[model samples]
Target: MDHTTAETQLLDAADTLFYERGIQAVGMDAIRAASGVSLKRTYQLFPSKEHLVEAVLRRRDLAIRAELEAYTSARTTPTERILAVFDYLYEWFRQPDYRGCAFINSFVELGAGSENVAEIVRTHKRAFADHIAALVAAADLPPARVGQLLILANGAMVTAAIAGSPEPAREAREAAQRLLDEGVPD
Candidate 1:
């Protein structure tokens, strides 16, 4: 296989293993074995376990952001874009292999003080939240109200993950719509 394909296969293998098992539990040797790549090749791609973990997270972030952008593009109104996020997340929750937020799970495994992992997690989360905030701003909502709605939207994802159900996400979307309707100036 080509280099890009090999790298993608490695990341796919890592994502499955890391998400199902914890990052700490899956070692580089295991990833190499699973990917059917030689140790030398694996190390060449990812010098350390930390680098592999970051690659898995970065891949996931890119896929999720792409999904959000595609979903939002179908809607003309900001409110629809906001609600589309819920629809996107709900679809993800319905997948049989769904294992909640990778970033949140990784953060739990790495704990609070891990600088590199924490930076990756924080950056992904802020980007998602900022996307929602931008949509709220486009709807002409005040900054404070936009922040509140974004929190509600993000809270929905966390709640759905914990509950292992999409109901919490649906509830959050409804509440966010109500907040927007009431809080947006006329």
Candidate 2:
């Protein structure tokens, strides 16, 4: 396979395996097997497993940003756009393969030991928060609404994953609506 094809396969395989199984539990051999890329070529493409993990996360970060934009941009009102983020989360949680946020999962599993992984997770999270802040601003909501909505969205992710139900998204949406109506207090 060409270099680009091989690299894409490797990233796709690693992302799947890492998300399905924890990062430490998966081996380079599994990525090689899943990607059908020779082990040597895999190593050549990604000098270390850490390199591959970083690449996979970076790609996922871009994907998630694009997806969030797609979800939020489709709504008419700024408030509706903000609420659509929860709608997106609801659909994401409904996926059969849904696990918790990949960034959070990676942070919990590898953040402490691997600064690279931790930084990647932190960057993704910061970008997500920035996105939320922009949405709150557009809605003419208080700056405090950013933190409130972030908590609701993130809490819903953990809650939905543990409870194995998408109901948390719905609950979060209701709570978000209340916050929008009631406004954040100082």
Predicted model with the maximum TM-score? 2
For residues 35-74, what per-residue lDDT tens digits would candidate 2 score against the true structure?
9999999999999988998999999999999999988999
Candidate 1 per-residue lDDT, tens place, 1-186, comes to: 678877987898888999888899998888888888777888888898888898888888888888888898689888788788777777877766667788988898894757788888998988888788788778787777667766766676678777788777778778777877786456
- Judged by lDDT, which candidate is best? 2
Instruction: State, as a TM-score between 0 and 1, how close model 1 is to the true structure.
Output: 0.90
State the weakest 10-residue window (summed lDDT) of model 2. 177-186
Off by over 4 Å in 2: 184-186
What C-alpha lDDT, on a 0 to 100 scale, does residue 141 get in candidate 1? 73
* Pairs with steric clashes in candidate 1: none
RMSD of each: 1.9, 1.0
